[model samples]
Target: MNRTPPSARTGNRRIRWPVVAGLSVVTAVITAVLGHQVPKSPSTSPTSAVPPQAPRGQHRDVPGEADGVVPDGVTVFDDAIPAVANLDPGLLKALRQAAKAAVNDGIEFGVNGGWRSAAYQNQLLRQAVATYGSEEEAARWVATAETSRHVSGDAVDIGRSDATAWLSEHGAGYGLCRIYRNEPWHYELRTDAIDHGCPRMYADPTQDPRMQQ
Candidate 1:
């Protein structure tokens, strides 16, 4: 009798296709879920990513507009220096208006000196004397605290030569006049100048009668 081989019968056995297909689908679903949960890098756009900067002249609230010295009870513009804050309100207003007009002609005005406390004026006078080697010589440049227009908040020392020249020519329109011929930077509100040109400048502060008093 010929015996059928048990190995030959099992050799033709087929794999279970349904089980494999089911396992493959489950694996794909698990992979998709993990991929979906993974964090992705954030995206940004030009408008959304950057912060805005403050425009010039809008930084009045910013610290230290000039030398970190703001006068008590005084407010100044961002474009202006601390010195402007110390000036008389009327004087500062006139200066700001003049500066605005000068800007249109490409001239930017600045204040090197304005109102000064009596103590500050005295300090300046002392420094001037040291530089010039005598009280008399210093007097020509700086006035005593008692007589200083700066202390009275009636004068301003404009910064920059371009601004000085512009004021010399057009300051009368704003009632601003250079008080000292030698110190062309010094200006005062001479309301009369608007109607009758700025009075002739004295040779220097020393030459003014007000200084004698």
Candidate 2:
């Protein structure tokens, strides 16, 4: 009655260690491979806030230092840079005169932004869109390529609080007037402003009629 069953024999039981270990390795390898994603190429899509109103290729991606990136310590008098040299002739003359006068007050007129190529202006609009979350909000800061005055060499953005402060006080004398109430750094030439004083400020680029273009 006490006979041991044949199924209870030690050698009769199948060992699953090898099969379980192999399956675990295969599962791990598959998981590792699936977890990673291949990277995609960068895109050059136009801004949704204000689409490219300019003709195609009008603002091609031009490569060079003159692509609207102002160097540190760059000033209104830095003609070596295309950004400074390519400004509207009358605007440049007015800026140089203003810079000369500002020096007497120990305020060097630094050029933060000026004479942007259309490509560069579009780059700025995209960057603004990224930072502000919405293209509409970005439009309030940066104008579209077709409407931007910087592309036309008609606008200059001054740097440093002190420089802008001095310009705010005396900029009208040289026909350099701040155009945007929100952007104290932005100024444009208004030749008549020399005698009649600067005109009323728009709240932002969005408020300017030209930006609607």
Candidate 3:
């Protein structure tokens, strides 16, 4: 591709060779020393271990997928979640009233779990069995979908020690009673509790006659 005439080429070849060769040598040496022909740019974002959730109802159902899933920070006022929204009107009303009063004492009510679909309750029972290593042991913790108070929107699991403690002290007036001594967070609406005080706890769900159903 050299377009110069023979005479001109001969005249300039010697003068250009050293400079061109020197530049080439310098570039090769730099490339060798850097161990790359080009720099590798860093990624702005790295991939996460957990996959991202699909949008809304379009999401695929895994074992844990169910209507009563209450993520952290869901409160009694959060009607957007099916767990809180589908609660029994009487139970929901009592919880809301108690939550409103709790604010005056510097306590906010956070809902851990509430009204669960049948599938959700069954999932919980399976989880309980896995955790306890036996269905008999698990029965003390979780109930069948048909018998579960959560599936009927009659029970709720409140969050945080301080909030439960506040409820323990004052919940009876609102007809909110802890059903299980082992589960301080679990509460149910007992309209009679407002007048007669809370009935004896069942120790765990296993003692409750309703679980036999």
On residues 23-90, what C-alpha lDDT tens digit does candidate 3 reach at each position? 99999999798877567765553663457776897964653324788888999999888899899999
Clashing pairs in 2: none
Candidate 1 per-residue lDDT, tens place, 8-127, comes to: 766544345667788999999999999999977679766788788878788434324343234443322433545676677877788888888888999887666776677777877888
Cα-based RMSD of candidate 1: 12.8
Instruction: Give me the runs in candidate 2 sitting further than 4 Å from their true place.
Output: 1-63
Compared with the true structure, all predictions reach lDDT values of 0.79, 0.89, 0.91
**Candidates sorted on TM-score, descending:** 3, 2, 1
> TM-score per candidate, in order?
0.63, 0.70, 0.70
True-structure RMSD for candidate 2 = 14.2
- Report lDDT (Cα) of residue 61, candidate 2: 60
Sort the candidates on lDDT, descending order. Answer: 3, 2, 1
Looking at candidate 3, the ten consecutive residues that score lowest on lDDT are 59-68
Candidate 2, run of 10 with poorest lDDT: 40-49
